[model samples]
Target: MVKSNDSMKKNNILSKVLIGAAVIVGMIIFTIYQYNTAKAWSNRIYPGVKIENQDLSGKTKGEAKSIIEKKYKVGIIKKKLNIKTDARNYTLDFSKINPKYDIDGAINQAFNYGKDRNLLKKYQLIKLSSTKKFDLKLVYDDKPVNEFIDSIEKEVNKAPVDATLNISQGNIKVVPEKKGETLQKDKLKKELSSKINGEIDHDIDIKAPMQAVNAKITGDKISSINYKIGEFSTEYGSISSPERENNIVLATKSINGKILMPGDIFSFNDIVGERTAERGYEAAPIIVGDKVDSGLGGGICQVSSTLYNAVIRANIKSVERTHHSLPSHYVKLGMDATVDYGNLDYKFKNTLKYPIYIEGDASGGVVLFNVYSNNSLAGTVTELSSNVYQTVEPNIKYQDDATLPEGKTEVEKPFSTGYKVKVTKTTTQDGKLISRETITDDYYEPVEGIIKRGIKKPETTPVIPPAVPAATPPTPSAQPSTTPSAPKN
Candidate 1:
């Protein structure tokens, strides 16, 4: 019994020694593991840290920064992020926006992961970071994006078309208003900013940024322009005067298809532009100064004159008008409206309740202008007449011409009769004289006839007298001999 008891005590002591040794070995192992792990993270990033999906494990801060900067900058700047819609597609280029990478900041963040924690907590942090990845923060300026969106807005926006009177193919009508479209710039800007910042690694789809715009003049506003308010026709021989006809055609083309709203003033010179050769005008006879001369864009006055009479018949108010220096055969005296580009212009106002469209056409041997509106003045008869109070006959004038032969006479210019006349417009409505207004009080200057007479004389021929025969010289020697002989005798 005593031997057994001693053996049990020895076994117990050996077991204690083994237990202590095992405990020491375990502590040593744990210390080595902690030291190695701490050492591994002392100058390097955690094992599981990544920058833009690029592994930055076991790298120092500088090394991680180089890797992240080089890789991420190239990928971002060289990548084309497409922003697409059904209508258009655009590319977001990082290079153009001056993209920058915060490699140092990101690397410092990754390197210091779990660095501030205690040893136990740090170990736990490292273990967590090893399995789960952390993403780096990215930043960029949105100025370029905003600017791009503004440019798109400008490109997509358009003004609405207003409803108004229009004339086409010699027919007058009303054109309906059209709605316009514009890009929603603010909305698009916000969306783009969000998209680029949220998803920097992939392309995005953007909706078409458009908004409807209403027109200022709606169809209901101009719905009253529907009838013929005034019209007149003037006869003109097409073959006799082509330049005049061409001038009429061009002026009428410019004036045609024109719409005048209520209270709107119409200026002839402003619409027709300058009459020049570059504008397809040919030289034709025009009244310049006080006489007829060939000038560019002549015969346009005839159009103005015709339109003037039509406007008068329509009962519209004339703002400005001037009679020609000489009477026009196309229209009665004191009833014509003459216009020069810079000096004179024919103007009038709509004065009516509704808008008016001027439809002019020069066809066959007639020039016609029909003003269309909602009001009908077709039954009114307008008669324009000029009564001459005093007549002035031109006198004959003479000029010297050295190029013509003597006693030859030629007519340089024909005489034109002048008159002091009063123009009247009688408007008879339903066989009753509604108004008798004096249109104009004109005084035309008389033009004298110019007769060119030859005053130059021809050169006279000079007559030469016959040459006298030379006196005979042969008697000199005989005379000397005879005189000498006589002296000797």
Candidate 2:
């Protein structure tokens, strides 16, 4: 009985195993079907893709591929619109797994990339300033250009974009164009412009340098030469600033008869006109050959002295000039230039390549002089202090004009100034004394007159002894001895 039951159990176990096997086969078939279906759906959903632009809304992969395949039959070109900015190669990654990877979007992106790659330039959209040039002109007279020039330089440095642009064929960056570089016809057609705006802010002529010019006298002191104002020179001071007009004449002459060539130097004494009332000179105190006297436009030397400085600051060479005998009170010592008519004079030659314009003025008792040039000079000029030499003179005897008092009644002691000085000129070139000249300044010494108050003393006669006239000296004292009796009678 145990054997039979065991056999039945075995059969039942075998049957169960067979049923399990059949179920496993059925499951395998179902799995195969599902896998094939999924694969067919994947192929249908995303077919051969074509990319034209970046944006794709409803286009399917198969349709996009058809359109691309037909249109791209001629072999698609690798376009590089901006080689420098944008890369030349396509950026799509096929291995990239994205559920929303649209064929149309990819096609659009590829087209944009290719278009940029095909161009010769890496950048575009340049502004007007990059291609524009600003023209400039020198309208005003030559003067100090420090401030305005600096401003112009600053503007140039602050330029936003470089004027030159580099471009070439087939996505290659070419060499940038330069000012004188050879360019293609199309490149030349693309005009580059730069604009600069500026004006004559301040008139260069209006700014008078007022430098100290070296004055030297080549003539002798005792040769009977005199310092005199020369002919007057006229010039316009300013057009805008009429109040700042400078129409005053220089105190001396520097150029005469001969026309000054370019680069000629000028001297004050040589150009000074004869200073006389007849020449429309206002009477002004002047140093006359070592003497103090009144002369025409006596104050005009202030203009000469002022010009003397302007020339020095300009760094021009001084040909000749004569200084005052004694240091002048108007200008500092070692900074005075004196002019004499006919004989004593000051002169200087221009030593520059360009012509220099001199502007002089003497309005309202003030003299202003200026020099204008295009460039700064190479050499420099510095002025040394002037020394005063007082020579002791022999006391001059003069018949006192009783009318003049010995001294002013207000002051206790009379002023006694007795000295003479010849305006001496010490000329130097490259720091070596080239020449020495003496200009005489004859200052008259006032003679002190002896004065006594005119008054009458009380009438007191000189004491005279009373005379006794009784006997007229009794007949000769000699007879008194021999004729005693006669004397008694």
Candidate 3:
């Protein structure tokens, strides 16, 4: 019995020793595996990693980057981005923008997976990755992509038009506003870039991206210029000179039916353009240097002068003006505004709050100009007065004439007087004076006629002291005279 009991005890001790040895071996193997795994993951992507379903397990970052780039990277020079607008397909070349996938970033993300987690979490990640691979997210520069989308906007965009006011066929009218369209650039770029970078490769059907832009000046804004504000007229002989009348007609046509917005400048020269022979300007009589001369645009000054008076009455400010060298018969002395193509011009500004229009006409022996606006100065009466402040008399001179007979006198030109005049403008409303101002101080030159008289013979002849007659060939001789005349100083 004692021997059997000792045998059972020895058997039990052997079993315990074997169990401890097995536990120690298991621990050593586990330590070696953890060390190997940590070392392997230091420079390589985690197991079961993928980029767009392409596995990158057990590969270094560089190798994974190469693999992904080779599979997904496309030649930008050959790629094209398709844009569609109302059934029109536009192929935009990708070379200019230089689009490419960000392979390095995707690979780096895959390499870092399961590395920053705790031991247990790392195990869980690995376990999860076994069933479903971890996808490396893709990224790219959006600047070039966005700019490409912007380039398409020019071809597809249409700008809106504002309503306008003008005269048509001698009647005031309002032009309606026009609608416009634009491409949906911002929204299109987002969707297009996503499809291009997505893992699934396929052609995308892009619907036409369009939007509406409203006009700033609506129908209500067109009503501001509906009424006449102020006007004046001057008379002209229509039948005397056909070309002069034609010029007046042409200039009036150029100025008539025009709109001047608030604070806008009306340039007669700029609007009428150069008055050349090619522009249908005929050679007619015009004033230059105090004389009537033939020039390209003759009687257009009559139109301008008439418009000037109308502008003054309308209370519009003149920007630039120069009077004729001599007083004009068409308009008042201080009221005429003449324009020389390159040297001089006439301009006025629309000082009213609302826009104004010009109505000009020359017909039936009369030339007329009228300024119209919504803010009518109908009850305002405009009156003009002129006062001769200084008068200059003519000077007379005489000259000897060799061609005319002796003691015969002839007049070359008639005498003329010069005068300086002051022009004043007075405005009255409701029988009460509103404003009184001096408009202009003008001076006219005087010209005197020239007279020439002829000299027939000498007044007296000098005689020599009684001397013997010189011997000469035989001829009838007279007695010598001894009277000598005094010389005039």
Q: What is the lDDT for 156 in model 1?
A: 66
The lDDT for every candidate, in the order shown, is 0.78, 0.39, 0.74
Clashes of each: 0, 87, 3
- A best-first ranking of the candidates according to their TM-score comes to 1, 3, 2
Name the 10 consecutive residues with the lowest summed lDDT in model 3: 131-140
Candidate 1, superposed: residue stretches over 4 Å from native:
1-175, 180-223, 237-244, 274-285, 291-296, 375-380, 392-396, 410-417, 447-450, 456-489
* Per-model RMSD to reference: 11.3, 30.1, 12.4
lDDT-wise, the better of 1 and 3 is 1
Global lDDT of model 2: 0.39
Error in Å for residue 135 of model 1? 16
Better of 1 and 2 by TM-score: 1
Q: After superposition, how far is residue 488 of candidate 1 from its true place, in Å?
A: 50
Which candidate number maximizes TM-score? 1
Stretch of 10 with least lDDT, candidate 1: 477-486
Per-residue lDDT of model 3, residues 1-489, tens digit only: 367978989999999888888888887786566666666566877678787778888798889878877777763345556778884687756555555666777777788887887654565555456633544343555677666567678777889986665665647778888888998876887778566655535444566579999986665654666655556676667434887877877788888766677888999998887888888888899987746789988888877888888888877768998788767776766778889888889999988887776777777767777777674566767777878888877676678888777899888655566777777888888679999998788877766657888876646879888979988887655975477888999
**TM-score on alpha carbons, each prediction:** 0.59, 0.30, 0.52
**Candidate of highest lDDT:** 1
For residues 123-167, what per-residue lDDT tens digits would candidate 2 score against the true structure?
A: 111111122111222122112223333332333222122121121
